[model samples]
Target chain A: MKAPGYIFAEALRNLIKKRATVLYPYREVEKIHLPDGFRGKIEFDRPKCIGCQMCFRVCPAKAIEIIEDERGKRPIFLIYRCIYCGQCAEVCPTKAITLGKVFENVALRKEELEVR
Target chain B: MSFEIPIGPQHPIHVEPLMLKLKVEGELIVDVDIDVSYIHRGIEKALELRSYPQGLFLAERICGICNCAHSLCYCLNIEQLLGKEAPPRAKYLRVIVEELSRVHSHLLWLGHYFHTLGFETLFMYFWRDRERVMDMLELMTGNRVTTSYNVIGGVRRDITPEIDSKLRRMIEHLRERMKYYEAAIRSEPSLLGRLQGVGLLKPEDAIRLGTVGPHLRASGVKHDVRLDDPYSGHEEIPFNVITYDTCDCYGRVMVRIGEVFESLDMIAYALDHLPSGEYRLKMPPFFKAPVGESLSRVEAPRGELIHYSISDGGTNPFRYRVRTPTLANLASVAAMLKSRGDYEVYIADVPAILGGIDPCICCTARVIITDEGKKTRRITTLTELERYARERGVRM
Candidate 1:
């Protein structure tokens, strides 16, 4: 017959084994990186944007607005309310609203953050 | 036939209004049903309607207690869409505010819990302690609960030397209080008597039901969202993850009681190693989100708050969804309630139970009332009781 002592030892091993609550992400956070198709911060191609107001109409939070220019269309943006959900870039026929890898930092004043 | 009593639709117990329909057989609760959803902001639906930058601000408004968490996660989702990151200095500021908010929230819950326990003296003491933490928050973010102090690139405000000193002092006072709690738990047999093994949720049940925050940690599980998903330079910050083995109400208190100290150590770490830089970066309100989807999780005062957003390459999100921690913890409450077969004994020390899981009722999506027939009771408020006491010629 198999040894009863071995069964007890196995039970002890399983109890501790089932209780491993340690998150291993700490050891590998450095190795992790976003895949190629990942999207993030919004970037604008000023030349391609036609000031059509399509992006503004498509904006859910009304964060997008048009600027007044003597010669052509204006592009304006407010940073304070932006959630960066990435809807503007996809709807742009000219691909003016592209997602860039630029991360903005905090500002002292609200007006300083508005980009046009 | 015994009647049922509905105690909500407008009640003082929860941060949000939750209606509780209790079937009672002569003051004994026979059956209970819960109904929520009075304040459903439809954040997910709203997310589908706004631009990326606008979504961040609105997301923060979802819960006043953890506005920073919702804002942080929303920013991360945008960053994921834009494929960018926040600078190191901004990251440190985020961590500082995050820990500060944790302290403020826990202090508030602690005070409320004491009020429920009929220990008004303890409640006053805890709230007095909370004022110190709130001072730190106001100094840093200009507002206490609605701290709209973060942006996509980094944090909106910076901490100066004076503010940092105030923070250190607050943490110092809190350390003394935390030590007292430890002593109280050790000596006050009544505390342990009421808490120990009162709501025993086996370890397996905790994990299976997806409990988060102190509720899960109380079960001897050391899972913290900051540790699991290190955002805002959390990977670099050094702090201990506290856990308990009791898996009962006492276990929950013990875990939270230990967290007060942990927050202090983290504040010290963040302050000493404070990164030097510009506080906020520039991101426009009319920014475009790339065509993508992302999910971000933050360790809020309650537990892990998860936000998921899908963008269709426009200024607005196609969908925005949030999974609050309390929602997850609610799943396990029935398990504990049924274990004792008595809500009166289990919930008699109301404040202690209320503080167990940090609740922000404002964000709950659904509240259901389960009862066979309609019944009603005119519950008297404390305000009314005091009036009665004075009129009856009773002297205190």
Candidate 2:
């Protein structure tokens, strides 16, 4: 019911427009600004942590584990298992654990994912 | 003589794993059997073992594309059990994100549908615009694909002014693009020829076979959960319900595209009238829900997604059930594919018919493990399924 030229013209118009594809890995891109409440990797502060195990109990993924050291008990985060829902960070009384904006946690070794 | 052509337990046409056994005489399909037992993660049973907060993650992961709907439905279900209502501001925010996800989901489906039909340019264009929606989701909820935004009480994050401005800009850009798309679809003779009068489903049959969402609407049945059962600030926001009476593949495509415009309008309204208050309530992490059961339904991108849960005064659910939209539409697919009387279906129309429902096979096929060697079927619980995988040293 319609002319064929119009369809081709419509398809060709996008060519003149700016490309929407992002140049990743090959080129340096613009910095991504995460919002204030962005839930990312769990960052635990050893000094502020009271070893109360609140983060451990509230964690959905069970990614946090508290271990006893000479000073006191400290938590280690298994990054791979963490769903990054920010429950641990929210439950932390002293704000020892927080969801940092560093979402690119890719590593070659499995041990690299474990953070203190 | 008729021949059986098995399309898939795996196929490139559909992104998800679905087995379609088609019985054909020449090029015409005579009969069809859809096997959706391949992808079962035991999510419902797994939900029964985890606590309420933990279960939210599992629920969201059920369907990657419609995670927002799953989490929202789960939150609404739990909130009903707790007898707690989210604040006004939170309700508006929920609507904003829910509609944004709907935009992204519909765009994704539209692109994929065209790609299946060999129109790669439109596919590329749709996906490119979809990225803008994904960026908005990442900006608002922190994650792109699976935005774990909805919590038990309300949304996880609040909307900031900066994000609001960006959202308005993106919506405006998409409006222009969608208009062009609408025009293109209307004029393209080849596209119309491929789609029109293919895979017909009558209105009575759609209701009889339990079709939901756009699939039902495509057949001239006016039904939508947002209209029927208003939830998450849907009552305040007004939008038109789109339906096409052609009852064919073209109608399905037209209905979805029309709904995208409707979603855009709703998102703009929600953003303009954004309320001020706490986005989430301070609920205890571990608390036993009172003995009761609640059913919650959300209009997912695919269709109506229902979540039912029973709590026996325990931290974990006693039983959890999920009825995905694709399961409801599968019977209708069988009816359409079968060659009866004047309706003749060819094997070439398989992609159009399957994609018409916008099938999410992963969500639909979450049960029934058959062992052909033993000639028996064993329904394994999540724990037992885990052990079975472990014994075989299989990484799922």
Candidate 3:
């Protein structure tokens, strides 16, 4: 039973089968599969945020910054610094912050990545 | 002449920045010295600066492949410090995620191992299957790699019925694929030729040299953190500890493959017998831990991962130490690489030997300054390192 190239059959069989990987960028966006509750880009709601500084304190990466304005206090998220652990969303009392499925959050500039 | 050949710091064979100084007579390796001081990020010092909740995220980044284990161990350590334990349901949920991650890690290792051994076909096959487990992780924990699922006191998320069914389906698919892979591995002559009778380490040597996880299990030693300590409600879950007596690279491969099956079963069992209660406990985010020290151990896919922390009744830990399994297993690698009388190690066999332990060099990297002139070696703390740099007329 100790034959050489024993895995060749499975390898050949795989050639006939559908390709496992999705052509994410090259093909249609629908080809890529993102599961439900996939932690990706951070989405912040200004009005819903209570400005308890809860997200700032609990953020391990210090990705969230509190800015005081006429609308009381709101958090500006530095998305590049975010680890995407969804801790801010989990700790948000008003359900203001949520991790959206838009995983392709790359940007040319640092400012573009920030969510206020 | 026995020539000294340097393998890495950056080499094709090493996956990470690991330098192996090999003394070789022709192709036979006479002696070896391993250097893993390349990528020390000073995570322990960083943990000391962060609060318990924040430290959990930092801990998860310690090892990407074993992030679940790292976060779980950190959570367990902090929970112990806070004099609290996760509820029954949370514990079971933790076990499910832990085992799932274990399966994923083992599969990744198996694929990477074959790739190192120059078996690309099996490598592709293994990784193709690993995507299933990754998808399941995403489904259950909201993220794929850095799940960050385990927080202090309890887990971050609860499993839904849909996820539970998907998990069971993944388990079934993996089991079938694993069975085929196991048979293929056993029957394939080329893989067996590379693995068998290579990287030989006796059971006694495995223990004396402090090898852990599947590497130790492959040496016919029954030392598992899950089996021995039973943290995170592992005591309730019934699973067999797989061991192989070959004490070679073959045994190591077999032990990991066996562990994948065991992990699948454990996940299945955990899901079936999951208790119904509060998954997460209500706790203030920015609270101080009591003045005490707590140590936690988890059976990470690589080996036994140890996390120790000391609290000075502050928002952050006074001191934090992490003993990654790769660090413990590196000693055994040095032992295995040397050429014995009948047991010879060749330059060709280096990859087989090194990959057997599933070396995660970044996880194992720690800074130790050895003053050669003074003949003294000491581990420098972050403060001491800064002070030493200043004293040496080096600007920060």
Question: Which has the higher DockQ value, candidate number 2 or candidate number 3?
Answer: 3
Better of 1 and 3 by lDDT: 3
Locate the minimum summed-lDDT window of 10 residues in model 2 chain B.
B362-371
The alpha-carbon RMSD values of the candidates against the true structure, listed in the order shown, are: 17.6, 4.4, 3.3
- Which sequence of candidate numbers ranks them by lDDT, best first? 3, 2, 1
lDDT of 3: 0.91
> Which is the leading candidate under DockQ?
3
lDDT of 1 by residue, B181-244 (tens): 5664555554566676666677898999999998899998889998988987888988788899
Model 3: CA > 4 A from native: B370-396
Task: Pick out the ten consecutive residues of candidate 1 chain B with the lowest summed lDDT.
Answer: B342-351
In candidate 3, the residue pairs with backbone N, CA or C atoms under 3 Å apart (3 or more residues apart, or in different chains) clash, namely none
- The candidates, ranked best first by DockQ, are 3, 2, 1
Error of 2 at B217 (Å): 0.6
Please provide TM-scores, in order, for all candidate models, with all chains considered together.
0.69, 0.94, 0.95
Cα deviation in Å at residue B244, candidate 3?
0.7
- Candidate achieving higher TM-score, 1 or 3: 3
Model 1, C-alpha of B283: deviation from truth (Å): 2.1
